[model samples]
Target: MREVRNKWVFKKVKVDVFRVVRRVEELMRELNDDMSVAGEQEVCSEGGGRWLRPEVGWVKLNVDAGVKEGWGLGIGAVCRDSEGAMLWGMTEHRCATLEPSMAEAEAILVYMNKARRRGCSRIVVESDCKVLIDALQLKTKGRSDFYLLLDDIYSICNDFEIVL
Candidate 1:
């Protein structure tokens, strides 16, 4: 009778432990879901909506950049018309590694230059990097490492009617 009682208690403890573990896993999943939803909402609000269509007679140039730890950086851009049709797209890999922000700045510079070479006069430049946009708009000449790149971008802006 004593042996049976001990076995029953052990089984009950094991089941309870598993139940607690299952609850923890469920909570973690819920937390991750909530975080992802929040992130999506933030992006939507910042981006002004999904797939922004450019104004009439203007081409939308969207640029993005990514950095790998040991590897260098990759930059890409897509130019689309008001009808949401892709006009041009390009991707370039930089052999020199850089910080994420610098990589983003480089992407804008490269894309704008390419567009200019392609004779795109009127463009709406779009980037997810709000900091870079704000800096460009405000003309903030800080002593950061991106200052030179920002200057170059401003200079490049002179070649076209650019709307950020």
Candidate 2:
């Protein structure tokens, strides 16, 4: 009876290993396809435009947010002058669980507040978040959970001569 149980356990372990290997292979293939598509898109878009420096005497504040499952969000910003010299950079991690859009809004709010505190009067804000940018541009108060954050961003914008 003990020998039979050992054989059954060994077979189960082998089957589980095979299933894990197959799943990993499938995931690898999917990732490879995604990389290829992203590479092609980058090549196509490279000729469209490039990142230009801010105007003379103005500093650009670029902000971005990163989110991970089971981990909170991270917000980062960098201030650079027209000569491409870094004036300042900051990063902060928040313990709250937030969606991507909300995290982006939070990043913008944090960076703008930091810039204000640093006495940045003439600033150009740049972000890859089109939704947040559009909301700020149109002054649209979104109905989502980010409404308060968006409002805060709008209020902060009034503090500086901002070019979005």
Q: Tens digits of per-residue lDDT for model 1 on 1-164?
A: 22332554455333354765577467545544543565432223222466556777889899998777666788999897765556778888789888888888999999999999998989999888888999888877967779889999999999999898
Q: Using alpha carbons, what is the TM-score of model 2?
A: 0.68
Candidate 2 per-residue C-alpha lDDT over 88-160 given as tens digits, one digit per residue, 9 for 90 to 100: 8788878879888888889889988998999998999988889888888888875767888898888898999
Top candidate by TM-score:
1
Q: Report lDDT (Cα) of residue 136, candidate 1.
A: 86
lDDT of 1 at 66: 77
Candidate lDDT scores, in order, read 0.77, 0.75
Model 2 regions lying over 4 Å from their true place: 1-49
Q: TM-score, each model?
A: 0.69, 0.68
Candidate 2 at residue 5, lDDT?
28
Residue 162 in candidate 2 has what lDDT? 88
- Residue 98, candidate 2: Cα error in Å is 1.0
Q: Give the range of the ten consecutive residues with the poorest summed lDDT in model 2.
A: 39-48
